[model samples]
Target: MGTSLNIDLTAPGARQLPKRTHVQYAALCFRIREGKVKVLLITSRGRQRWTLPKGWPMAGLSPARAAAREAWEEAGVRGEVLETCVGGFTYTKRTSPHPHMALVYQLEVVSQEKKFPERGERKQRWVSPKRAAELVEHPQLARLLREFHPHLRKH
Candidate 1:
């Protein structure tokens, strides 16, 4: 996803902030149980920090499809991916100086496999959306999780 900035050039010493040079697509995997939203969060491979399943764009997949693929690969999540992006956030990894923006799509999870690509490499858990927000480090992503609501129309 592309973002546009509205800068005021007339302001004294005004300058444009650097755009996010790296982009990733992510899946906010969730399911409703007992009338409550349960979110699935996975730990990062290197940092062990909780986060959504995300990755760089794939050559031929659409953004939502790529996000779905990441969810499956990273967390064994198989679901219905909504093309409507819930939100996006920018952050810089501890290992790199470049800022990365992640476009997030909501995935209403159908099932989770017993084994998947990253199953042994990372930890996964199911928590409330608020708890999911608390477990993640990025404030913007946290906010997105906190504010997330299921689509009223059935899938």
Candidate 2:
């Protein structure tokens, strides 16, 4: 004897999705001056949108390390990246159907070079957190920038 069972997926009930989501790591690089925190923002290559330094995970590199590398590559930033994730945000890419979740790590910037890998391709800026919040396109990222507070000794 054999038995078979079937269920309607679109019967107006909760259903589980089998979709795959991509993950990227990002660096929220910042420097403190006069007790105010300023964050670095870079222009995206395609749309030229203001955004943080972020990229896909690299082979043989940890998430935080990959984010630090992205910071260096995108904005000429050499900094200390906190291993703990500050927060995450999701966005859909133009070429892919899967949404990408970006995990953000706080990086205390040490130095920014006059020339970097993406210098000719993008514009960079350092602005107060509130200003940065206003500049970025993503709402969640803007909120993260708005609520950011790093507890570190003043330099």
Candidate 3:
């Protein structure tokens, strides 16, 4: 038999490739104010790239509830989440521990916290959906935001 080579994934020095696609909740946090539609975006923890608020499924909450929780944790948003998911988009994976598939939920933010979870690690922004589409790196998410304008209902 030929000599075999092996590397330990659990080793501290070994680099880990992204695992299989993970199903996660994405908060399509948005609001209508002053006759305009605004979407919220938050920066990633380490790389600081702009992204939507999202996380793994919470213990007992429904998907939309979990998405709302993510919004509050990542963006300090408190709001009503529409049960019907507007759309979903595959996460464009980069160098990550786990590649993810995100189900996007629309949230109508009613209040925002001045101090909340992840405040120090992230920065939140409210901008026009068009502007959000321009800033986000994920292609499907960007397109979702771009085409979102027509769905706006006067609030």
lDDT by residue (104-127, candidate 3, tens digit) is: 778889899889878899988999
Error of 1 at 74 (Å): 0.3
Candidate closer to the true structure by TM-score (higher is better), 1 or 3: 1
- Among these predictions, the greatest lDDT belongs to 1
Give TM per candidate: 0.85, 0.84, 0.80
Candidates ranked, most accurate by TM-score first: 1, 2, 3
Worst 10 residues of 2 by lDDT: 1-10
Query: Model 1 residue 109 lDDT?
Result: 92
User: How well does candidate 1 score on lDDT at residue 68?
Assistant: 99
How many Å off is the CA of 45 in candidate 3? 0.5
Candidate achieving the largest TM-score: 1
> How far in Å is the alpha carbon of 126 misplaced in model 1?
0.6
Q: For candidate 2, lDDT tens digit of each residue in 13-92?
A: 75633368788899999998897889999998889999999999999998889999999999999988877788777787
TM-score of 2: 0.84
Off by over 4 Å in 3: 1-19, 92-98, 149-155
